[model samples]
Target: MTPALLESFPPFNPEVRLQPPAIERWRRGTGTDVEFVHVLDSGRPGPTAMVVALTHGNELCGAIALDTLLRQDVKPLRGRLVLVFANVEAFGRFNAVEPFSSRCVDEDMNRVWDDAVLRGARHSAELRRARELAPFVDAADVLLDLHSMQEAGAPALTICGMTDKSVPLARALGQPETLLVDTGHAAGLRLIDRGGFADPGSDRQAVLVECGSHWEPASAEMALDVTLRFLRHLAMVDADWADAQLRVPAPERQRLVRVGEGVTAVTPEFRFLVPTHHLKVVPKAGTPLAEDGGRLWLTPHDECVLIMPSRRAGMAGQTMVRLGRYES
Candidate 1:
């Protein structure tokens, strides 16, 4: 959808509970020789894993977690650990009064991941940053792209791209109570779905963690907890170090939700019949969920779970939400 279409929708006002951390000290990274990219190598043979933050400017939880990691001087024990602050230019423009307005400086960074878009002539603040970070992302064996939600009170979720490789990894991290397996966005391929990360046969894997609401302090804690667990899972960081850093206990169990279909807006007048949160379940089939134009959107099956229901103004072909079912 176009920026004009997004602008047409009324802005959502979420309560701000967490203050954005000052990231000026991390502008010059210690490793990789790239700005805002730090790489710590143990000089031993193991998988290289990368944890990324700030894919969207306003998602402060990931940034805060990464910043804390940097300050703590966390280092890898066997493999390489790469910490990246993506979309710094957009993040530089973040204003507490108008947080959502600074999500990107040009186009959405997450949407410009396809090879054609990166190699093509299109230029933007986000594209340039992604281009610089692509080599690092492409080289990693494991990746964790941290993000947060727009909807208030929505539970944390792990978006494990349409494959089972990342499912075990998500389950191992054990935070964010819900694991969603789905194809990447229709708008574009995300970093988690790029190259080997999306290839089922390949050993590479990536998971996008939507920690919680954007401005919540708990979201930042969740981000750090998950990141530490991820590093521990890869054997990049010592278990003792990870345990010391963890703020909350790992989840007792995780519910896996496999998305069956994405509900894209076919008409401009799309509206949900009920207020939905992430992972909200409808117990019966044919239940009215939304309306688009004169058409009523109904649940396709019993126990249909709603995933990431949109709060933004609906544009034609924009994903309003996704329908899924529990696997375990």
Candidate 2:
């Protein structure tokens, strides 16, 4: 009775440079309804800023970033700061030897944020947590969900859902040069897209930052950097302290890539034709990029950029890569 994730695929043993912090110390977080959730109120009127980590159990960088903040006793200067360690059930099972196996215990926690799924009769470890976490997420005026890529050496990026509001904020954060503007996933709605954050008229905004490779030491640093930038942008933390804590320089300019579509693996035999360590562009239309059980994925137009090409090859029904193009 082995978990599906533990099933063998291609061998990938990347160096685990960042260690998962001892989170048990933060278990009874501020007496929140859910464990590992802390709320820091500044006792002044302002927007509620939420920062979440461990959306996926295997992504250690976010956990590290949140842990660092907790240890430092970071407090919001203007309003409430809600810190969450999501998917702790799955995260509790993390093992560097078989890292990906703990991404979730039942299903992806992120994809369970849809209203139907959350209110539905369906049961899963992720959905249950999402239900417990929904209220805090709904209460936020802004949210930053930290994550990392599955592939090593992949460049850092921010996932600004097909929303006009988030892009401007991401541009302000500056680092993670690539900003991916995408439609909500076909699988399910993500936490960032949930509630009023997705409404055009709503002031609330959410951004998901893909820090870097999951186990890379640099990813943890980038995670913290983004968290600081997010707080600084919202004027949540002390200006002097946040500025001193910042490590990565803001990018000179950020590029926005609007995702056209995601290439889903229909079969377990899907394979990409090229190495996708970083973002790539197919120079011409109709060029074959991948094949899955005789079905070929061809570029729809020239200069099509491939985003976040996955390392998990044998997983069917998952998005292998996203097709997008740069603006201007």
Candidate 3:
């Protein structure tokens, strides 16, 4: 399906539970020369850790959480802390009446992270912003890109993009119960999958946190809790300060969900057999899940779990859902 055709689908009309925080105060950052990028240096030498929000403009939970941290004047004790409000241009377009319309102006910002794509001739609002943010991303030793889901009722997950280094970082956060390990979309590379962040040998690691449903108030709290835990793990922020902000108890053990395959829509006629929630486990192999152009898509393995089943209109090559299995 064409982009125009996909966009013709109805606007998302979910009830707005989370209020979008006013970020005018943070437009000009201290320390970092860049706009909307705040850098806090402790003067003592340590790894630079970054927390990025608003990759998709409609996802407001991250924005709220980041704004809270900035307002609190949460500074690192040892290393540098970089708090970024990315895709602000797109974020400026967000409206409660039509939240999904503001996802991007040109293209998905998360998809254009490959070196060739950034250095190549292709230009868009997202590409230009990614290019501008490249320097900060390159310098970071550890990073957290915060995001939210389109579908509600899905459990929060930390997406560790097919790298061993990121696994421990996700484990360290420990609030989000599931850890999703994948290479990323077939469309292009994600920020977490870009350059040294995805390299196993490199100390640099990045994990994208899908906090929860876009418009849910709980999602914002989840984002804040996870962000604090991440900073505490890196020893960037004081333990007492970080602990005071947490609203949820840390998970005793995190379940590892290794993505087996992404079910991409081959035709626009993709339809799920039943309404499914995220982490919905199918007990048997060959269980019918979806249908595409008269062909039935079944579960490939027993105890198959569905992750992030798309509620939006499916286009050709778009990920309709992801199938995964639990690891030890």
Candidate 4:
């Protein structure tokens, strides 16, 4: 099946210029080799912000961002910067699935960042890189995991803002227009938890940002600006970093259709295949969403918000599914 996402940026030559630094290397699993680009700044060493990309093979926005980030001349004020262009093999796989090939080569890379799997020999290349990057995480303070989605929605802020400290950062991030999802966990642990650290004893602030739909050319540029803004926000970048403000466009807001339920046919363009029917409703539960097996199927009784209604992608399920929303 074709993946409803895409991205494109120039190649990044780490050695061509002075990058943060290569702190370490992890084993790249079968048919894959991985390397992490680690950079350290002692100018005013304070907090550490680790930026990672390409956890998913097909998610290209982050990859493009990494290319641009690697090439940029960023001098930090305090703390350090860890820039990683991860999952080389999965990322290198030619993704031409649908809109592009579903870039998921082995399995979803983001879903398998478990320690038990990492210690074993059965894990994939991504898992190993996640484990390798774990240590650098402990040495620093912040982590920004970049990603994209399958549908057309506002460039969202999916911060794993669960802790007291991280919550403030996430809240700051989810400002004028943003949705905060408290994974009911800490900020920097599990890859999803934002607490995913290499060193267990270190303090870390982490958040995952879904820039926009896959294949957005502008998404890469947006990521660069946001990273710069984030650095300034953290006091890592120069106080007067050039144009470090990044905001969502008002028109982009209209694309965020507060995804209702039911099996609304998903067109490749990331829009509803047909006009929305009376099948689903937002902020409401137990409502009939769509027809399955020729009968009215209802939504689960919960405060759920949907995103990226896909008819295909995962195995055996309904034609479409709902994404859990961030409770304000």
Candidate 5:
């Protein structure tokens, strides 16, 4: 399906960067060591925060932002700060010029969650690596898994679970396009959403930060700003950080929807409308939407976030569309 949707997914073949001195490479479920960034401040013990990027190799925006942050010489406040370069091998295969492939390698990294697979024989290396990052998520006050999504979309968006603790945090850290993707399915489980066996202790918070489409400058910049704002939101950094980037002013919390179980299939030759990442919505009578493919396919009837179809089209369900309203 994916192969037919777009021409082909591309991979970037850049030379790998050596590990930094402060960062450590540790082995977990994955036998080989992957680099993890851990900064501790026992001087004044406080809450711990873990920021992870590149769960999906193709989602490179977050990786750039985190790598940039790590390079910045900054001191931690009261609590400790940990940064992880979650998936390096998959990221290495990234090709900003192409789509689909950027998000993953052999299998989607985000969809590698399950008790059976976790307990499955030594399967794909990515599956093992995911288990390795579990401890980092468990030890934090907040977990921000940064990622760059497909489609030339709006401001930063978040994928959160159904919980008051999660809701308020998501709302508080609102991005202008505060799209509440119900994910009719839960986070991480969907090949698109990527579920994790992560823990949710009491009110611990986790967010899948979709920075922007791959390679776009705006996507990269937004990703960098949001990571810093997150530090302030968690008090990991101080006013200094906020004062630096206008601090993504209180975002206008917009429409929220459930990423329900509706399937949108596309033909092999489906191409995105160029110039802008715009996908036209074709709706049917007595039906919320319809497209001319013989008969209109029925859609979920409700105020839902249309997973905006990308002008850059792919196979069906490759992308979804939505018209978000201003949340007063």
Candidate 6:
């Protein structure tokens, strides 16, 4: 269904700075049944770590990082290192002029991970692709799904879903100054929140890294840095080599941001009080943050911090922005 809202209140057109990396070279399967999925088996027993990129086609930074890693022939030293280029059909449609339109072919791939959606009769370009990738995703011991924000100048952060297992892992990564602990979206379950990754009793772990703005050079750099750190953390790659590749210095300490609520757009007329609201904090409770048609959306608590405020057309049921607070 077409979204009820078809326009950004004040149209947002950010400059596209980074070129999408040429990924046609990695299309062929590398001894794996899945196309664009390469596995580096160390032949030694250890964890199966999977790193996925291009969850959103417009978010090219992760693809750049994965392409660079594949070009360098980085092999695992422990168990298997699974490198995935997801949503390639949508990625193939990426046009520099209209980048965001290609986020998915039919629907957002990130939201189709629920078991019923994966197993049911729902048909979409993303769902079919998700089904193909589900087996590998389920087998992973540690999963790192790379993504980027729509808004520029937003801080790099990690989405550690509502799991105790992931928060410590995100903290240990030591980059990306902020960490978000929240439940999976009401729209659908994200890949990180699927299967054993979200199970407290299971030892499996997953974290989604929002490197930075979609086309920024820094976002690509951050993606590669986090990729190296993730592999190093699992001992899948050499610590010294990974350290040498790291360009960004780790923050002295990371802040935990627990999301209290996600304001989902219910009407076509959803518009923020200001043009941009990423990381903006409302000092008082009940301050009007946005308006959805005739309904007003207010801050539920004092010092409500907005995270990843979307500039896209407010589709009904889409999360406009998440309200959160920083932990000391």
Q: How accurate is candidate 5 locally (lDDT)?
A: 0.53
Local distance difference test, per candidate? 0.88, 0.87, 0.87, 0.50, 0.53, 0.88
Whole-model alpha-carbon lDDT for candidate 3: 0.87
lDDT of 3 at 207: 95
Worst 10 residues of 6 by lDDT: 1-10
Across residues 124-147, which tens digit of lDDT does each residue of candidate 5 receive?
767767777655555677777777
- The CA lDDT at 248 in model 3 is 72
Top candidate, metric TM-score? 6
Q: Quick one: how many clashes does candidate 2 have?
A: 0
TM-score per model over all chains = 0.93, 0.94, 0.94, 0.67, 0.70, 0.95
What tens-digit string does per-residue lDDT give for candidate 1 at 1-328? Answer: 3443344344568887878888888888776678999888888988899999999989999999998988888878888888999989888888888889878999889988999999999898999999999999999999999999998776789999988889988988878788999966788889999999989889998999999999988889999999999988887788988898788766778989999889999888988876677788899999888878988888999999999989876888788999999996
lDDT sort, best first: 6, 1, 3, 2, 5, 4
The 10-residue segment of model 2 with minimum total lDDT is 1-10
Residue range 155-222, candidate 2, lDDT tens digits: 89999887777888788888789998887677788999998888889989999999999999889999
**Top model number, lDDT:** 6
Of 2 and 3, the candidate ahead on TM-score is 2
Model 6 gets an lDDT of 0.88
lDDT of 4 by residue, 219-286 (tens): 55556655665676787767565344354442322112233333433332233222221112345666
Local error of candidate 6 at 250, Å?
Answer: 1.3
What is every candidate's alpha-carbon RMSD to the true fold?
A: 4.0, 4.3, 4.0, 9.4, 6.7, 3.5
> What local lDDT score does residue 95 receive in model 5, on the 0 to 100 scale?
55
Model 3 regions lying over 4 Å from their true place: 1-13
Question: How much is 23 displaced in model 6, in angstroms?
Answer: 1.3
